[model samples]
Target chain A: MQMDERKRKILRAIVQDYIATAEPVGSRTIARKFDLGVSPATIRNEMADLEELGFIEQPYTSAGRIPSDAGYRYFVDCLMGAQTLSDEDKEIIERESTKKICEIQEVVSQTSRLLSELTSLTSLVLGPQKGKSAFGKMHFLPYQPGQVIMVIVKENGVVENHIVDVGDNLTAEDLQKVADVFNQKMKGYSLSQVKRSMLHEIYSELSRQRHLIDNALEMLDAILDGSEEDEPIYLGGTLNMLNQPEFRDLDKVKSLFKVFEENEPLKKLLLPRQEGLNVTIGGENTLKEFRDCSVISATYKVNGKTIGAVGVLGPTRMDYGKVIAIVDFMTKSLTEVLARGKPRGYK
Target chain B: MQMDERKRKILRAIVQDYIATAEPVGSRTIARKFDLGVSPATIRNEMADLEELGFIEQPYTSAGRIPSDAGYRYFVDCLMGAQTLSDEDKEIIERESTKKICEIQEVVSQTSRLLSELTSLTSLVLGPQKGKSAFGKMHFLPYQPGQVIMVIVKENGVVENHIVDVGDNLTAEDLQKVADVFNQKMKGYSLSQVKRSMLHEIYSELSRQRHLIDNALEMLDAILDGSEEDEPIYLGGTLNMLNQPEFRDLDKVKSLFKVFEENEPLKKLLLPRQEGLNVTIGGENTLKEFRDCSVISATYKVNGKTIGAVGVLGPTRMDYGKVIAIVDFMTKSLTEVLARGKPRGYK
Candidate 1:
């Protein structure tokens, strides 16, 4: 059931037209608009063959034809051309991506939002890989009677905070000494490097401080080693999903809503272990619920190292030509800004 | 268009049965299952009348009846009985809710996951309301040369960190003195309470200790007063939406996914600032895309004060009977655990 060149052209034309108008496409419409130098009869014959091959379907006896799931699959893989972004679109993405690079979280969050706004589709951006960050410094400050605040700063400038118990009584000088020791020894080391041996070394050194902050030191070790829960997942422009007609069915709406509710599947779907712009079409996503949808994703980098993934989700009928171009340009723009590694100076 | 008591009972029976089975309800089947003490013919006549009034529909001439949108509306508003949770369900919720209350973010995230698992439906939870938590303390710790980490602890035991710049050269002693003054003056006061007059009072006093750190106080004030953004919205079980029959249509699926992407709309949807459980059925929600859906939500509290909202989303065919009971009970359980403040001293 292989399609000939003319049949491929007809299939692409139908899918393209259906995506634009969201209406069933007819042979007469394609014959008149596309100027393929074929008569209505010949075009109709090709459409009949296309339908026989499962690429198109007629809603009823009198209605026009629409692309079946198989039709969209072929269009995305073989027929669709790479859409070129307008100069204005490029400038918009460049401005937005470069606007905030100092804060990695901000860069990812803003990039998702900007991509969603530019494409008018749902966008997702994963945060920087925590495992990759080298420890730059850590500071412990006492707050109240029993609570202590711990801030971990990575070499890439990402800062995270955790609160741990410091028992009932501790002097300000004791906390300061603990902070100084941590900064001197742990700086420039990754979290993985701060293993049990490193903890034993720090514990023996703290014994010389008369047990003043021994509890705080143990708590610091726990905070650094145990805080390996998954990094935050950034989602943006969910409202954009509402604009697509695929969500009109009540059941389809609910199932898709469910996918957006739990983010673990999405995080796993966009895992940065993979390379290039990965497109998971219907039945390809790991999650059974997203079987009918498609995910278009790519990894973003900073200084030539992959940091996280940025992706967009829509129905299998997703306009791949446009979304792919936007995602491709956005990944490049994001890499350029993040590589600079400087906060946008305030006006 | 008005129905007698018997017709009402029959409509309720049909809707409830149809909702559970997702099958057309036949008169004979209803007669046998419900023991309505009426003949199948009598039930058939009433069902015919009901269909004329748009309470039910027949997919084909020979098929049994299914509840129409009007029938579902009626069941939700007037006929549906209050749902009671089993002891096992209550215990599971209580056990999960009481695990760790100090981590407010973790509580919200886990609660959303638990609710989704319990209901087998999508769940959404908003973060703690900023205005609800009074600021208790602020501390500063220096990291590297230009970076200073600011720790703000709320009265509810939530800790937040922000990294700010304090020029290029400041020692540990200077930062400690600056922190001491800030804690002494601003302890037990909210961020809003730190006004210009109060900032000036702290600055003039700090000038007496270290002029180098005093010069950095203005930037610190700006960072403290202006850096807070809206809290993040917690959503879970979005992938579950794909499991429902309602979202099978791509347009509806896209619309619902779009809602999860935009923070502002989601914040507005979840934060109506209303009291008690808020149930917005189809067409009642402010967002047009949600007109075909229903949201069952309730506000959770701490120490008898309203803090945030947790909700579940589904199609108009959503099990209002079950979700309403679950949301109400979970909110109560969450509030009780949070009010206790600390974990049980089992250790």
Candidate 2:
């Protein structure tokens, strides 16, 4: 049998109704609520065909139907319609996102909160990659007689500082000269670019300052690639997920919570497939915790490179059209703010 | 009407059993589970007096009894005995807490995760007050032609850097001179001390560099008291709270979650009453969201000052002995780490 237009309309109505009421959608309810322009008997015949084709499922003996994972996938792929966000929502998202946020961590945390508030679902926001920050300025200050602190300021205004001990051979003036040499060579380059290409030149020029350079190079790598500054997922309004009726089962909530605590698994689930919005329906996700959830994510960017992602986790009965629209708008707004914050000292 | 040792033992047994099972305690179960050496008829009579004293209550018309807020308070105050953690639990907590974490925020986040994991309850770890960090070192680095970035390294390895614009008269030499003067006077003091006592002396000496000094002081104040670095309540294992049987009601769970999101309310709830463990039973909480829950918090200190707090939030039938022990142990471990991490620049 062909998957025709009429069957598509019926499936959309079922998914929409289940999302609204958290109840099974019956053929009669569809006939009454949605203007599919068909009788309940005809709708029932179409529902049977849809279920047979695996686009929908009858959960139990007497209950109405729910969209299966394949059903949601089909709808997302071929049938999802135009999504419009309200003027009020657009204003709120824009306002929260455009605040003068200097640090990427703050931006991620704020974005996560706004997404959760706007959509009433748990939101996860990871910061731009550590390598995304270009080297702006590095400062060398005498911490004590034996130790010096190196502070690296990124053009985007993130400051990461670490301590290193210097031998008696290096004076405070020598520290400044060493800093200037590194600064001149590595200026305007992000850590990723520097690590990939610039290390050979840096290592050769500072050969005479071998003792200090050894420690300095180590500090530089740490500043660039270290996990100390690795921005973990900023989870916001996480409890909002409990509002869903399907999570009433304690065991179900426990399994999902475990995945959240073990953030790496959920991070894998949200990692971008291509670029833009990626939706994984129930059973489409490999993690057992997410088997009951549908994840909708969008990778956010800075200067054309995809650096991080934002995601919303909810029951499969989520309002895909509305949530997708919110996510799409949020990522764009985030990108605009990031563009405005061009790294300082890049020249 | 005389309250004797037997009555205290019965109340303790009832509270302990209710906490363990999340079920109403009955006279027969008490006889079977705890060795009170009393008949069911005698236990029933004692239970009536306990209820009359507002320590235990019956829901609807059930014969089984659950402890009321008053009962919990009575147990915590008098009947509760000291509880010890197992050797395995002690080792796990010590290992996790004693990791070589230098940043206060990372320390707080790790501690929160450990507390939540050890107790199987939601944990809240507040960061130390901003004024708690003493000055370690300050570096002045040239940035764009008109601006210079000032990086302040705290003893705890936290680096805060901000860009400041310099005037035309302030040559590179003058910048170094101003830095040396400020560094000489402010080397051993905290930001609070610098702001409180040394501002006048420094302002008079660097009067020619007043334009930069004005902005630098303003920046210093902002760094010391800014909300950007405000120690937010680091909440961990929040989903674990859903595992409680009491959270089976979606509405209750939703209301409680609202408090978690609106962190100010929850912060108020956890703020220390004194310097040690604070046990606020269900009705004892001022916040309405916590009326059905209990909180156990202990203030963690650095040096001798009480800097921040750590707490656990759970339903009133919480395992008080275990949770209290965990909170107490976690706070002490945190204090030791803070002590070891004395700010770097302090003489």
Candidate 3:
């Protein structure tokens, strides 16, 4: 299983050639095209060893070999060279990152579209985790006669609103008083940091307004204590999968489409587990639907906190060296753009 | 050519048979399947007349004939029978309509998914029009040292927020005073109804706070006067296109995918024009990409005001009776569910 220099060189050649041409690589083709400084016979012996070790597989007895999942894993891990992004791609990233974005959703969506277009693969950009954002402000605005729109603004500038029925008895002033008390207690704490004890303490302190604002308080408590909602998945270039030769079979296309429709499984696959870039090749994926695909994802940070991730999905023979570079570069660009926070033309 | 009862019956049989089975309908097959009293030779003569009239076309020289776009239109307009919803589909629609939907977005998205699952064709649901909703209330909440979140809530319960920078010099009290002025002036006026003269009057009245709130006012003016922003398209079952026999060719799939990816053309095709259900078949579509397809769309209303639409897209040989019935029924169900507006468990 140890990959010496010669074996590594040959394996890299096969994977790269297959990725570029979507054609299996024979020892003769490799020796002719890759300039390995070795004869076709010697390369043939090495190819047989690679196949024996499970790095490559032949689709037909007579056909040449293509990379197995393990082969791609090894190629991505040990042999892939540093990839410099094309100037055209770099320009697109710069232009999108520098655009006057009014909302974080726009940034995430633009990034997803840019990733898909550049790499010609399906892209998924997970929106920032609202649960991780520190409380900035809260407002209770009177809506129809019996309803109120409760707005929550997070430190990272994400906003969420829910309607609560308070009946016609309570005036706008009454709701304002409750908002003041809630804001005083919850400000600067992330949703996860606002524990049950803290909520109980706040309830006891607001005993006088308790009955009138009970429903609002309960709703607030539920939101703070609830399991994290799924981050909105900004899917882009879903049809790009059609361009890949691996998805020519309609069943594969259907399975992939079903995964996109369900969304939870794909989100689970892309959820950032740790800092930095990661690649899951073929069988490395736990979901059966994605077992035949490769995913390259990188967590993006804002003020040193891992807030979201952008990922690319394609066949296992994906252009790893290029897609990985684009994804890695995108995360950095997004981080810088978000951290700047001062959109051009904003007074 | 006038369509006599016999011609109509024969054309209906041909269209229905072709729809049920993807194969072209030979005169002999039609004679065997249908209880037509006429002989095969008589049916063949009538089919030839239908072809001469451009209602049907033979795919190959000797193969049976299939309905042309004109034939489908004729079937839909004159020959198709009223279709009743299957009990299973009715149950699904009723269940979705009655479910606890906290937001209009949830209802629209759920309906799109339901449409796709029921018919096994791609579905598109256009969300409610924000421009049509009357103004309800507006709030300006203080955020970071130099920023404010401006929230506009329409009468229909849609909420939109934008961040405006007002600098640290303006206090929360200043924002409240500005909001009071805006609420008093803009309440009950739809965005379309707020005239330029009315804005001029407000600007003159807020002359004292003009410099401090100039950017916020300009943003409001821009939003009020700008063309409508694209309503979010809730697309579902895009991969369902592969299930159609006509889309087996990769080039056709790619063209359909490209249309979905671009969105503007598709949205234009689906935008509700009139009050009732409408169907565009095959060559009738203005877009070349959709010329080989059919789209059935119906606008759903709330309180008798048309606001949104739901549509089904499939090949030219789509089950017109079934899809038209579903789309028409869905619009009615959506209209009723939306008008109720009172979600259960809202306390």
Ranking of models by TM-score = 3, 2, 1
Better of 1 and 3 by lDDT: 3
- Model 1 Cα RMSD, Å? 6.9
lDDT of 2 by residue, A1-347 (tens): 87999999998888888889989899899999999899999999999999999999988976899999999888888888788898899999877866776556667778898999889998888777665556767778776677777877766566667777678677877888778887898887766566634566766766666777778767767666564354477787777777788888767766776677666886787787789999989988888778878988998777787878899988888989888999999999988877886533111
The residue ranges of model 3 lying beyond 4 angstroms of the native Cα positions read A1-4, A133-137, A154-157, A184-227, A342-347, B100-102, B132-137, B155-157, B184-212, B221-227, B342-347
Worst 10 residues of 2 chain B by lDDT: B338-347
Report the lDDT of model 1 for residue A228.
46
Per-residue lDDT tens digits for candidate 1, residues B88-155, read 87899988865755566667788999888888777889866655445556677655577777676666
Docking quality category of candidate 3 according to DockQ thresholds: medium
User: Cα RMSD to native, each candidate?
Assistant: 6.9, 4.5, 3.9
lDDT of 3 by residue, B109-163 (tens): 8999999988999998887765555565678876667777788775556666677
For A107-202, candidate 3 gives per-residue lDDT tens digits of 877898899999999998887765555676779876677788888775656666677877677778878877887789888886567788877877
In order, the Cα lDDT scores of the candidates are: 0.74, 0.80, 0.81
Q: Arrange candidates by lDDT, descending.
A: 3, 2, 1
Of the two candidates 2 and 3, the one with more favorable lDDT, higher being better, is 3
